[model samples]
Target: MQTKSAARNIFFGGTIFFFVIFVGLVAHSYSYIVTTSTNVKTLTEAVAHGKKIWEENACIDCHTILGEGAYYAPELGNVCKRLGGKDAVMGMIEARQENEEDTRQMPNFNIKGKDLEDLAEFLCWTSTIKTQNWPPNEAG
Candidate 1:
């Protein structure tokens, strides 16, 4: 262990061992994602589009989803259930589209029609996920 050669061998061996472990962990995580997480059947093209729309709009900046994101706005993980349904969700978004009110500074994104509907669908999809009873409140 005192010799330079022995020290180098130990360093290289540990590096390789850790690298293998990292690769194995990555593989295991990928397998779990493919086999256990995400209901792929529910991920229709519309849902993907809705997710894209959500990202583009940066809704997470304002609202929380599944206990993630900023705390500025209300948690939206179960918004569909709390608000009533997708239609109600749509109503809220549509109402915000051309909003001219001088209320809390939620800027108008002008989202309407199919785009709004698709966003609602994405929100509804999130509502149905198994969150182990998160948001803790039925009003979320």
Candidate 2:
């Protein structure tokens, strides 16, 4: 009688443990799906246009953004903030165009007005993404 009772208790306890784990996993998955779907709709038209420019220019070929590209140049994930602001970033780009020195050659794309604004907005948006403090330091 004692042995039978011990076996029944062990089986029931194991079943309950597995059931709880399965339920938790399902709940976590549902929450993740909902959150991701909501965030996906938050992307604006400017961001979409900036994405196209980034792609067309092959910016990732040299610079890494959020650690997803080549490492030849500085990571531009938080460049907007690092440069002080969106306008400052545009100024820096414009300056690079005017200077054109061999020491650091960032070719002037001649991006102007709305294009610059959209690009800057997209970069600012990228900087706000949660990356757990990627690039590890301001130097990136």
Candidate 3:
């Protein structure tokens, strides 16, 4: 009788222990979800348009932004900050259209005006993602 009672106690205690662990893990996951969801920036129509442009142009085939896409070109995850601001990004795009010898030889997409603005906005939005300093440094 004594041995049976000890075994029963042990089984119940182990079950409770595991249940508590599972609850803690769930709570932690929920907290992370809440925090990250709140931190995410709201996507606008222009940003969506710019995202479409990025996809249509296959920009990911060359550049890696926020650790997604290809690696042939420089990481543009922080290009806005690196280049100064949105205007700088537009200027670079315009310059790429004019300059024949850009480092990567980006094709002159002739993307201009609002398209340029939208694309820059999209890139800026990507920069704001809370990736925890991904790519390690700006040189990526």
Candidate 4:
């Protein structure tokens, strides 16, 4: 019963409506990322150095950060917060132990000195990123 012209009008109207909605969502996401997701003020030389170490060692091969890497290891997005800060993070890295019965263990990366400090700083900075409560639990 509908006229051809009316059907065409409906299709065009729906396309435009959806396009507008898509644009709005994209803009909102950009604004959120620029304003709330990351802290540029805290990105320091140490953090950059830590990130370089992370990449050089291929840490992403075993661990997930911000939910983006392999799931073989625990997510480290909030490790600084969970473990209580930079010193604790370094301690855990330095003191990693392997139980005989455990099938999986974190190998000692031999990270020390300024490298250790920088890596900790990187992790702490990562912890500060707003993930909207990702990993969903304290264990990650």
Find the candidate with the highest TM-score and give its number: 1
TM-scores, each model vs. reference? 0.77, 0.68, 0.71, 0.75
lDDT of 3 by residue, 63-105 (tens): 8887787878788888988898899988987887675763657
lDDT of 4: 0.89
Number of the top lDDT candidate? 4
Q: Rate the local accuracy (lDDT) of all candidates.
A: 0.84, 0.78, 0.82, 0.89
Write down the RMSD of candidate 1 (Cα, Å). Answer: 2.8
The residue-by-residue lDDT of candidate 4 on 1-140, one tens digit each, is 99999999999999999999999999999999879999888999999999998898888998999888988987889999999999999987776633435457777678899999999999999999988889799877
Question: Tens digits of per-residue lDDT for model 1 on 60-105?
Answer: 9998888889888888889999989999999987765655576466
Those runs of model 4 whose alpha carbons end farther than 4 Å from true positions after fitting are 1-26, 97-103
Which runs of model 3 end up more than 4 angstroms from their true locations?
Answer: 1-34, 37-41
lDDT of 2: 0.78
Question: Compared to the true structure, candidate 2 yields what TM-score?
Answer: 0.68
| TM-score leaderboard ranking | 1, 4, 3, 2
